[model samples]
Target: MVEAARILFGEHGFHGTGMAQIADASGIRVGQIYRDFESKEDIIAAMVAADLSDFLDEAVLAQAIAMGDRQRVRRWVLDLMIRKQQPNDSTLLPEILAEASRNPRVAAIMREGDQRIRRHVAAALAMLAPHAESACARCVEELMMTLMMGGCSRRMALVEGDWQFLEGCMARFLDQQIAWLADHDDGAAAADHADA
Candidate 1:
């Protein structure tokens, strides 16, 4: 039912989609769908949750980021920049974001999803920089993530958008950030060696 709603919602937007239509798409009876879900809001929340579950597992990415693997981080960012262009799994993101403006529940779900990514960014900062807690690091990370999301939004707007442009932008951004991180790591290593 949720999958059917995702497709319908993507096609028709939230307001245009109806429970009966979702039932028809899923081949499930409306009565059963009502029994399964509390309300339309509940169904919407569940759909967002299920989508976010596969979106990004921060636990795994955080592990990779902490290990100072630049390629790992780059690959993840590259994947993100191009995700909307992929043939399968057409996202209902624009519709979701539209609903989020007026729907507190949807807004909260979106916030939770963005928060997870932000936490990973913060964690990576902590791992790579001696001054991760400083204002400068916070500012740079915020700028980077905001731009990354903008690139994602742009990609979704086009039928065959240029993923390579975003990828290149991210590559340069990562190179600059990673160089700073490496410098911090090197300084910390030198300090440890001197102490030894």
Candidate 2:
């Protein structure tokens, strides 16, 4: 049902798609669909949860951190910032955002998903810079999220020109931020040792 909704939502905006359409696409009865999901918002929540699950495989980051692989951790953060979006995502995300502006339920769902992603980002930042202030991590997190979302908008807008150059610039920016975090944290650690 969620898959069907995703396709329909991508083709048509959130308000454009209907439960009957989802049921028809999924080959499920409308009653059965209702049994699983109360409304389109419910389906949206499930879709977001599934996407988050696929993206936030914590074990990968945990393993990298456990091995003290700073490079891997940095790569992980960089990948999150510049990950490729699925074709459907490019179509569907904007639709959802538009609907979210009018629907309180959808807005709440988006907020919760955003918070989950933010927490995951914060954890990755902390692993990269254990001594860095939370405020610093948060600033990095906000910037990364903005760039990520902006990339999605850029693709959706069908901007002309070479994307690789833009991607390279983004990667360099993130690399510098990560390096600053590492260097700043090291300095803070040394200061603590001196105080001790």
Number of the predicted model whose TM-score against the real structure is largest:
2
In order, what lDDT does every prediction score? 0.69, 0.83
lDDT of 2 at 146: 96
On residues 1-196, what C-alpha lDDT tens digit does candidate 1 reach at each position?
8888878888888899989999999999999999998767778888767755565555556667768775676666555434443332345777778889999987887888788667766665555554432555676578767775776676566556556775677778766875665555645666878999
Worst 10 residues of 2 by lDDT: 178-187
Model 2 — TM-score against the truth? Answer: 0.88
Model 2 alpha-carbon drift over 4 Å, by segment: 186-196
lDDT of 1 at 63: 65
Candidate 2's error at 10, in angstroms? 1.4
